[model samples]
Target: MKNEFKGLIVQGDKKFSIKNAKTDYTGGYNKEKAKDALVNSKIEIDHLQEKLYASGTYSLLIIFQAMDAAGKDSAIEHVMSGLNPQGCQVFSFKVPTSEEYEHDFLWRHYKALPERGRIGIHNRSHYENVLVCKVHPEYILSENIPGFTDIKKINKDFWKQRYQSIRNFEEHLTANGTVILKFFLNVSKDEQKQRFLDRIEDPTKNWKFSSGDIKERALWDDYMKAYEDAINETSTADSPWHIIPADKKWFARLAISEIIEDKLKSLNIKFPVLDELEQSKLAETKNILLTE
Candidate 1:
């Protein structure tokens, strides 16, 4: 697992460049290789999840962000399938309700954070403040931050402030025993178009497609710029973003699994220790069982 696919990102250097950051990773999606990686990652993550649960030392928060048809749900399902259900929870965020709109932007997100010794996965997260809100500035009006009515100033500072806020929030979580792993599934526009077309053609998947998806795709460049800015600004050491190559489903799954496995391994978690007295008691119980 260590050497199977290190630095696998095909255009990773360019995409990660500070000067001209890009969000496309279509070149690294090898279906056969990805399957092997995913298999190994599943074993590692499962073992780590058990240790994390037993030791009760830390919690994990995984965030996934992607455009429509970028396979966020499928990624979560496949990558997390091996984990103990009792030790993990998944939250899918949607458009805010009236009640949600009444509170601060992070309030609803804060409510879904994982408890001690568990993993929480967010399909979309508080990043909406910078991504979706950047695209649709009117959404900021719903946040109701004081003096935010001035569109000009709000546009200028909203995303920068939100980026700082997210950094601070994640740092606070880390200080309080949380390990956050964020992934921005980078899908190509052509792949997305193919996926949308598949959804339209298939009866079972038709429900997932909507006219709004096309409308959203029309603003593709705007969203890409917003994404790049958000990632560059908010990706700190405490809560770094893994820009996953997601043009292919299998490769996307493998990258996600690898990132998760790496995060869990970094915690150095181990199975709970039993004292000598407890070990002796367990031996005695084993003897009794043999006699019976």
Candidate 2:
């Protein structure tokens, strides 16, 4: 595993630093290069997953966070396309259900965690408690916490508390043999506008483009601030966030593949060795084949 944090911005004010950590992949969106990287990454991840499965130890959780039209879905699809379906699961978090709202915020997230030897992907995760909740406090009415007062102060305190809770939760998971990788797809405003326009122009994609999307776009600056704050507060050594430059989809996929592959490689997984009896039987089979 690469000990050096690849493409991470570790400096003053993680929130502000993350916003400025953008890169233009010199290779641009080359499908061939992207696909090759994806294939290699999947192979490495699969090998590690197999070893973990055999050992009955360690789970992997990958979280993807991005603004609307930031290629989160596409990145996951392309980067992990070659992985075995049985060894992986994907969870897309959405508006909380009545039952989910009844429990604490983290409870719902905890339930979806990956089991040992498996890889789990979260499309948008518990961070919503801070991101969307901070942007639109009206969303919290669904939570139905009694005597909710001072919405501004309450929201601020809630996010800070949530960040701490998330850190503790990740620590617990790590202690129990889980590796967590969090990613925030960083897309520029110009690129986002182009994507939105593409959605409007293409009939098949029109359904995905809701009028509410524009409303959200209007609050881009606010959301950006929220995202920066969330990433800064919660990004810890146990579960650090990778701020992926997503203006170019192919490059974004490539970068993600590299990160995942490196992490898997660090696990140092290998196929189980055969016993003496098994080795002798294999030698006999090889001799028979040679004679034939």
Candidate 3:
């Protein structure tokens, strides 16, 4: 983790209260500084990713979770600007399709994971099963889960079990050389309302506004508690969650890219070196080319 932004992390033994977390932090950086920082981080990431691909020893899985208008899309677009497309995979999860609903919640996500030496990004990930479904237990009925048709049965115990499943799933991934980083774009209700209004007022952004968004906004408190519980429950040492201050979109992108660079730097990945046999073969090939 970056030294300046270390306080934002809520993982393992760190207790979290979303109500107390900040919605805007620039980490002493102004807009110009933050933009410069983001660009530098992207450059570092480009070199690091090439080394990662050559080494092929590890993979990175980054998860983003947030309320509407929290800037998840923009953050991804900016922070990942210079990365090679072939080494990166981005998945945006919406409502589950019929086929997806037929399987375990983690099945599709597990299949979408990056192969060795690549990075996988989830705009909204498996956490949805616990967050959104926790907010609306009725949605669980659609999955046709055994003994879960009754909303009454979707009790505290059911959520605890889901959290356990997530922990186990991440544990399995980490043990197999996949590093996980989860981020929650913590935006304030006031800020969100302003953003929603901006969307409605601007003709270009009018399509972003939907009546369903307002319906979800009405349940903001419920969603907050759901996020609080999900973050506290699933965050582990290996798979940590960072509660990003997202009210300032530029700062959010800066912080995210910095954290990513910090993690990749920790890996100390390097390009592969040829062995003696390969070196001799290369020399022979060079001699043949020279003769030609």
Candidate 4:
């Protein structure tokens, strides 16, 4: 099943198509089965994260990019609930503020990188510069890049530079022992409409609904093209992208947790081994405590 999920990985060697990606995939998995699998995956993730923290050699950066109401928040909450918060940092990138706008796009994101021995989760990350701003080029103007007084200057070369910048950024992190897992939650347009309707019809979820969401839905195709291009341009062997089938939240959560577990196991991190002196000290301390 995990290997099947690997099919969702956007291979840089191949031509990526967002339209062909699965959104409502269950792989014959029912909700109960997925939930049971998720429980096991979470337990393993907790143990693996402990090894990562105890070893303090590598960091894990999990990035989530998706359309509006595509379950990024819920996926983060559920799949990551088992992690030790002390060794985990989660940052949600909303619209950039005046201060964030002052620097290069990656500046704020770089500051949020997880230190070795921890897991960092970014909800809607640096990819937004390419995904959102690609659809609406005007947003790039707010960055105030010199020589870009007109939208005409923000042409193909400009986007190419941005994608290259992202690749360089991830490559540097991987070189420095940060394992990157990028997920693009693939939710069908019909599924998104149902979610929006749920948010509207249920009083408890009304806060989640916004008129802007409807406006964005109108540009679904544009966002898809942006996402397809962004994934193709940035995905690499080091920083892999998983296009999760997000229409079924349970399956998506299970798949993501399993993928994360697989990556962590591949790292083969273990608790730091103490030297002979430290080991003797542990024995002496235990003896003293027992005598007391």
Candidate 5:
């Protein structure tokens, strides 16, 4: 049934097209069915998170990337609401500061990674170096990396190196017990327009609307191309990208939750068990506590 959801996972060498992917995908899906599934998934997620926390053997890293008005914030909020805050950490990355730029692109992201028995959520993440910086290459000049004085000199090879860097970084993480789940919220341009309009019309949501978003919207095609290239380059058996349909926010949330739950389940995590000696000590401690 999960296979029926096309464009859900980007497999090997698949050249993804943002236009061909369906945003409002409700071919045979029912709202009630989705709601029920989401409810169950949330409960399972809460349970799995407890196991994950107690096992202290593996960590999960969830990465979300999308264009403006793609509902990244809402998706994280809804899907992760049930998880314990101590076990889950969320980081939203913006433009790099002078201090950040001094280090490598993935430096800050490395610092934010969750330890064993935890979940780390990257709202925007290190991919911004490839997506936003790819669209506007001039931003790279600000980094002042060695041997790149001219923005015009930064060509495809430059971005290619960045892609390789990202792939290597993710591979390293996966090799060391970090399970990576990358989600690209595939929101259509039309849906985004409606969302932007809603933000403008709703007085409370006006703060969410920014003029810069409109400017970025103009480069929708460019951004899509960048995303396509990045996903294609980085997706692997260890860490794959899921192009989630974000037109229907509910469906997106449900899908995200299911993926997360499934990944955690695959880990086969279990709480530590006490040995015979430890059990004996524990029983003695329990009897002492009862007497008290």
Candidate 6:
């Protein structure tokens, strides 16, 4: 199932175009079918996560990036539903705080990385520095970077440098036992409009809508270009990007679970073996407990 979506995974300096991508793909899968698959995936993920936690051999870092109303939150909530809370950490990055701006863009992300045996999820991650900031170059001024007093001086090279930095960062993590899985939820513009309308019409979902989302929607094309470039530049064999067709939330969730399970399986994770002495100690403890 994971291989079925390899086309969705950006690779090898490919020229990516959001216009050429699909946002409602289901690969002949229906919602009911996808839900069943998701249930199985959740069960396996629960078991794999237990082994991953107990083995203490590797960590998983899942990064989600998408436009507003693209279902990043729900996807994370559902696909990670069965994970142990003790082995999972989720962080949603909004605007950079004053203290965050004090350091480099990737600093906070590095600090938030999962420890060995845990899974860390980033709702909107370090990729924002290149995506949103690229779309709105004016946002660069807020970073307080050295020698950039003039925002207009921020040139194409600035973005290139950031992309290189991101690639280096991911490679470093991969070398140190963290498996990186990046998902770009590719929701269509019309679908986004409909979702926005749903949020407006549904009183319970009112809090999810924001005027700022509308403002950002106005720059949809620019954002798409930014995503294309960023995905193309940073997606490597070690930390590849999966451009998920997110209009159909059920399919998207199922695809995400499949991809996650595939990665976990590839890690060959297993529970740690007890030494002979440890096994003897365990037997002694069991005898004592039974006698008690």
lDDT of each: 0.82, 0.80, 0.92, 0.93, 0.90, 0.92
Ranking by lDDT: 4, 3, 6, 5, 1, 2
List where candidate 1 sits over 4 angstroms from the true fold.
1-29, 276-292
Higher-scoring candidate on TM-score, 1 or 2: 1
Enumerate residue pairs that collide in model 6.
none
Lowest summed lDDT over 10 consecutive residues: which window, candidate 3? 1-10
Candidate 2 vs. true structure, TM-score: 0.86
**What is the alpha-carbon lDDT of model 3 when measured against the actual structure?**
0.92
When 2 and 6 are scored with TM-score, the better candidate is 6
Error of 3 at 78 (Å): 0.6
TM-score of each: 0.89, 0.86, 0.98, 0.98, 0.97, 0.97
Superposition error at 139 for model 6 (Å): 1.3
Model 1 agreement with the true structure over 41-79: per-residue lDDT tens digits: 899899989999999889999999999999999999899
Query: What stretches of model 3 exceed 4 Å from their correct place?
Result: none
What is candidate 3's CA lDDT for residue 28? 92
lDDT of 5 by residue, 1-292 (tens): 2654544888766767777888887535577888787889999999999999998999999999999899999999889988999999999999998989999889999999999999999999999999999999999998888988899889989988999999999999999999999999999999999999999999999999999999999999999999988988888888889888889988998889988988888888988998999999999999999999
In terms of TM-score, how similar is model 6 to the real structure? Answer: 0.97
Clashes of each: 0, 0, 0, 0, 0, 0
Please, what are the lDDT tens digits per residue for candidate 4 over residues 1-292?
A: 3666778777678768887887988877899999999999999999999999999999999999999889999999999998899999999999999999999999999999999999999999999999989999999999999999899999999999999999999999999999999999999999999999999999999999999999889999999999988998988988878889999999999889989999999998879999999999999999999999
Query: Which ten-residue region of model 5 has the weakest summed lDDT?
Result: 1-10
With a 3 Å backbone cut-off (N, CA, C), the pairs that clash in candidate 5 are: none
For residues 16-100, write the lDDT of model 3, one tens digit per residue: 8998998987789899999998898899999999998889999999999999999999999999979999999999999999999
